[model samples]
Target: MSKASRYEWRDQQASLQERMKGFMENPGTEQLQAVLTEMHAYAAAAQDGSIDIPERFIAFS
Candidate 1:
């Protein structure tokens, strides 16, 4: 790789490392569970035909 490409790769790797370090510091289990529960509720609603599937979700049959 050229010198410029090597520098760019180092910068990208450093940014990714920083993001990963920050993510490791806050795992947010409770928040994740709550969101999962909400998604399950939405899935149930869609199955029941009472509510439409959310626009952003691509649930596989």
Candidate 2:
């Protein structure tokens, strides 16, 4: 993808995170754990090359 597109995806992910924060504002402990588990899966997928992280994230390195 183009650099601009990568940036856009990164922005979208950030926006998703913000939205999730609101959705989870009063989540129970189990719900919080589930969110964390999903996040870990997302990270693992990215690390395993099963998912492609946006260039903006790569650029952070």
Candidate 3:
């Protein structure tokens, strides 16, 4: 790739990484709900006997 193209790709990657970092740090309501729902469902039915939980979560009973 050309120098300019390489730079552009790097910039895009950096932007995506930053966005992901921010999301992980503070996800919105929808994101939090979806994750909780998924976890609840997994807990209810763990067919695979394995689940990957996120580093942050809040489950309301």
lDDT of 1 at 54: 30
TM for candidate 3 is 0.46
Model 3 gets an lDDT of 0.53
Q: TM-score for model 1?
A: 0.44
Question: How would you encode candidate 1's per-residue C-alpha lDDT over 16-55 as one tens digit per residue?
Answer: 4555555567657755555556556545755776543333
TM-score of each: 0.44, 0.51, 0.46
lDDT of all predictions:
0.53, 0.63, 0.53
Root-mean-square deviation of every model: 16.2, 5.4, 14.5
lDDT of 3 by residue, 1-61 (tens): 4556455544544454565565588899765665565446555533543433334545464
Worst 10 residues of 2 by lDDT: 52-61
Please report how far candidate 3 places residue 41 from its true position, in Å: 31
Q: Number of backbone collisions per candidate, in order?
A: 0, 0, 0
Which lDDT tens digits does candidate 2 get at residues 1-61?
Answer: 6666565556646655754685578677766766676577667766776545654434454
In candidate 3, which residue ranges exceed 4 Å CA deviation?
29-61
Which candidate tops TM-score?
2
Clashing pairs in 3: none
